[model samples]
Structure formats: structure tokens, C-alpha cells
Target: MENPIFKDMLVLELASVLAGPSVGQFFAELGANVLKIENAATNGDVTRNWKLTTEPADTDIPAYFCAANWGKKSLALNFKEKEELQQLYKLVQQADVVIASYKPGDAEKLAVDYETLRSINPRLIYGHITGYGAADDRAGYDAVVQAESGFMYLNGEPGGGPVKMPVALMDILTAHQLKEGLLVALLRRERTGEGQLVEVSLLQAAVSALANQATNYLVAGQEPKRMGSDHPNIVPYGSVYTCKCGKQLVLAIGDDRQFRKLCTILGAEGMAAIPAYATNYSRVQHRQEVNERLSQLIGQQDREGLLQQLQAQHVPAGAIYTIPEVFAQPQAQEMLLRNGDAKPGVRQIAFKVQHQEQAQLTPPPSYNNYKEDKID
Candidate 1:
């Protein structure tokens, strides 16, 4: 969070949950002054109550709420209050950006939609996120969106029931999409001297992220099936192999050469010599045979030793690390963001840039923690 490129900029956050809050946090991490305006009537974001049994029942700052709320000043307001509405408008007059996730018409009802806010400050950038598109108002939860967008259909093992992803995948994807759009909007404002609204929806983000999988159906008339971790286009790629210590490793062999190299490492060079398994296409055709043989060979070795061997040989393979193990790694230390007594959050901006030296990041605020008094 040392990058101060957004220093002195003001961002008003009218969003809650993951996507919009994440966008606000992105600017906050980059040193923008972000104000998170929450609904006081409901006791702030719904995620504040999403906690494990281990978390304190009395606290408003649950770990889930902290996921994207870091480095923000919170002001909880009941929108029905006229004085509070005027207070928000006063701040909006000076704000550079506003990030919101009010479904379709909620913003208009609250008199805080893009048109209203832009009238107060023509230079204000508006970023909005939705469950579906701007028109469809059906609640767009990640699990339901995954089902609608074909992700659930193609995610699990072959012949098993469709499964939703563990994380809020659609929200995360939409957050990234909104960030890209808002950055572009900022650049556009630099040239036009006028701000514009940038909108992204969970359904749009999820569908667009299908990438090659969608092309397989549209261009080639192929219906993608659930193949577990295996890739349909690449032989021996995305294949999960188990080792002696019960550790799982995944391979990402890119081409015939890598497949041959993998075969040599597995003591199965003879398999590569056979016409049915010699090339990527052939190996893909005879995938069951290839996988069975490779599985048997891999199951005999220790995970750490084999992982080292693969790395030394420049093979594209990786351990299936648990969540705790991922953050425990030395390289992941750089991504850590500590904020007061709350559990640490991760940095949203992954890229590095030279900026002013950073002070410690502030933790996600409690409901109405800063109120309107903190605003200039």
C-alpha cells in the first residue's frame, strides 16, 4: 500500500459486500482518501454478520467484512435523514470518484445515482456494480450466477453433480472488471475534463471470463464437460497427481516437448515412444492410458523431492497448497496488509510502482467509526 499515486484524491464508497468495497479498497491502498458510507438503519454491511463461531458475536468488524474494507473511514447514515443526505452531497461536490453497488434503482431512490451526483460535481467518476445487467434486478449471488453462466456445469469431476466454486468467484471477477473500467474512466476524465459512469455486472464478468471455454462451444460446436483438473486442449496439462505423502501436485505441460520431458522424469519415456502417446494430440486421444500410467509412476515418489526435481528441470508443476500454507510462504509475505487488531488483509494492487514511502495501513473501520466529523 506504499504507492501514493492517488494521494489527495477523494473516493466515496456507497457499496458494501465484496465487489464495490474491493474497488474502494483499491483506491485506498493507492493512497486515495476513501470514505465508506454505510446504511445505519441496517447496522452497516450485511457481511459484518458473516462470521465464524470463533469470531466475537458483539463486534461489527467481522473478518469477512474486513476482506475489502481496509484503509477506509466509515460513516453510517440513515438515508431517510435529510441532514445526512445534505452532508453526503456536500462531500460529493468535492469527490473525484464514487463506487456504488445499489442493485438497479436503489441509487435513484436514494437520490445518489450517477446523474444526481454528477450534477453536484461534473468531474466526478461513478463506478457501479450489479448482480446482472442494469436492467435485470434478480438477486445475483455468486452460486446462482455460476449456475447461470456455465461455470458450475463445467467445474467438477466427470459424471458428478455440478458444483459452485468455494469462493465468491463472480463478485471477485466483477470487482476486477469494475477496477479496470474505473481506471479507464479516470484516464478519460483526464482528457475530457468530465467524468463518466462505468458499470459492470456479475453476470457480464462471469460470462466474459469463460474465455476459451466459450469458444469451444461457439466456434467448434463442442460442449465442454467437467474433466476435473484436466484440460481439454492440452495433454497432461491441468492433471493432478498424488504423491507418496498424500500431497497433490498439478502439471501444466504446455507442448509435446514438455510432455516428453515429463515422461522422461516419470521413468515412462517408453510411453512417449509409442505412436498413440508420442504427441500432444495422440496423448489427448489416449488420455486415460496416459493418466493411469503417469499416476502409477507419480504415486511412488515423495512430493517435496519430486517438486524439486520438476522445478530443477523447468517443468511447469506446482503443489496444491492449502489456504494457510499459501500465506505462510516467504513470497506471500510482501502481499500482507496489517491493520490494527483485525486479522490482516491482502493487497489488492499486485503490481509494484515507486511512490512515497508508506505508513502502516489502517484497519477496516467499525460501523460509523469516523462519522461525518472526519470529512473535510
Candidate 2:
């Protein structure tokens, strides 16, 4: 077989929980030999027992850890130990990259910071994922960053207090950005053979992921308001109507053409003549009016009928499918939302990578089981 893209890569991960370890996992999936070094006292990454399950054994199985920590070799070491520190320095010398999310002063205190590690290996790519930017002294957490970045401000219904997301979206987003930074540094090294530092802060990453919302705020001086599943710039562009079948349909009419098509399909062509609803800009201005009209028109239609009507008009529309419905969806399964067999008998439910093969979803390893390697 051909060699993997990251065949020459070796990563030393001193990260706990999601963000930093997630960076290592991505590299490992790309064929890097990633070694995740955790503290022995912690026993392993604490995400191991986060999720509660019915079976008692499953709790200890660390299903949470299994999500993003696959394909990595685990080693437990006490950084405070002189011998362990020495061994870690040696490992750094041989590694192509070092991933860490230690607090600002903590890495230097432990002597594992990139500044210290770079002295041992000039070609090592040092990946630092932190809560806030290095320049800012503020510490970051998912909810706090969400609030600070103005993301939470626009998350819920209009007039509702900001609600944090159910998942660590900002954290996961930072992981992906960190991976990109690492890969960029790795590519740069291919030419200069000189390693560099790569840093991703949760706060900045979350702000970046806000995309146009942030742009509108900064450029257009518009404060983003929560529309409560409604579109800010277009009418009929959110959870439009719930059907008799108890399903919610998200309707998106992007432009005037699509809006006209929707009007025809819903048998409300007269709505097209409304001066305030005639253009995208006007529709946005009178979003409340449009929503009320559209709701009245489609509220009585069953989900199946609405889908057929909307789709036939070539309007961008879809049902807000439940998590279960997504799995049952032929297209979603075909694209491999559920993936991997790294754990032999245990199934792996990995995130889908676009245009790529399934991830190596191995079972979460026993505490420090990977330390029996030749490197140690």
C-alpha cells in the first residue's frame, strides 16, 4: 500500500479532555503516529467517565473519551517526576509536533511549554490550544467563551436570555482550527525545516465561527438580535411551520425567485403583490408580517404534503429531523455519519469527514495501556 500522508509524523500530546487531544486525533486519523501523554495521577483523560449510561460498565468505558481520542497511543507520566520529565524531553526531541492546552504559566512551570520544548527540538511543531488568546490573560470555558464572543447573545429566541449550546461547539471548532494551524506549520517545515508555534484560543475561534454575524456587527454596525429560529435577512427562512405529523419544517426562500415559487406552491400568489413583501429587502423589513402569513398558509398542511409542495417548487426546504431520523436517513448513513471499527466488536460513531474514508474509531483504551510501546 502507498504510505500515508502523515507517515513521517509523530505527535506528543500533553492535553487533557477535548480541544488539544482532538487535534492529535485528527492528525492520527491522517496517518500520524500520535502518542498522547497524560498524567498517571489523573489515570487518563477525565472525559472517560463524563457521560452517564444505563450499564455501569459503560460509565467506566469512557464513551466520551472514545469520541475524539481514537487512534492515539496513551502514556501516563507524572511531569513532576524528574525521571519522567527527562523521558518526556527525550520524547519531545523525537516528536514532529507537541500538542498542549495547559494554562499560560502552567506549561513553563512544568517545563513543557513550547519555549522549553523548542530548545530540545528545533523542528518540532508546537500546538497550543487555549481558552483565550495568549495576549489576553482571561481563562476560557465553553459557556464563558460563548457569552464573551457574542455567540450566546444571538443563540436563542428574540428577547430570551442567551442560552449556551448543548454541546461544546466552540471547543470542537477550536480543535479543527488548531489542526489547520498544525498542518500549515508542518507544510512550512517541509520547505524550511524550521518548526514554528501554532496557537488557537477558544474565544477567538468562537468569534471566527460566528462568520457574517460578526462581520455585520463590525462592518455594518448592526447588533445581532436573536430571531428565535427566524432569519435575520430573509423572510420564511427558518422553522416555518409544524405539521399534523408533529414534524417541524425549515423553509428557506433565499431570493425573490424562490419566494415567488413558495408563494405559488402555497397557493398564496396574491402575497407576491404585497409591496412590503415583494423584494428580499422588503421581506426582511416586514419579516413578522411574512411569518404570520406563511404560518397561516401552511400550518394546516401535513409534513409529507408540505415537503412535496415545497420541493416541487424548487424552494430550499427541509424537515427539522430528529437525531433518530438522521440515522435512518439513507443519504446520511450512506455518507457514513456512523463510522469506524477500531474497537473490533464495539461500534464507533465518528464524525463525518467530507470526501474522506471513515475515521479509525477504536474503543477507548484501558488506562495507559498504550505505554507499553518501544518509545518508552
What TM-score goes with each of the models?
A: 0.96, 0.90
Q: Give the CA lDDT, 0 to 100, for residue 93 in model 1.
A: 87
lDDT of 2 by residue, 158-188 (tens): 8788888887888888988988898899899
By TM-score, how accurate is candidate 1? Answer: 0.96
Q: Which pairs in model 2 have colliding backbones? A: none
Question: Model 1: per-residue lDDT, tens digit, 280-376?
Answer: 8888899998899889999998999988888888989999999989998877988889855667788887787765555356898878888455454
RMSD of 2: 3.1
CA lDDT scores, all candidates in order: 0.88, 0.78
| Predicted model with the maximum TM-score | 1
Show the lowest summed lDDT stretch of 10 residues, model 2.
341-350
- Give me the displacement of residue 5 in model 2, in angstroms: 1.4
Off by over 4 Å in 2: 53-59, 334-361
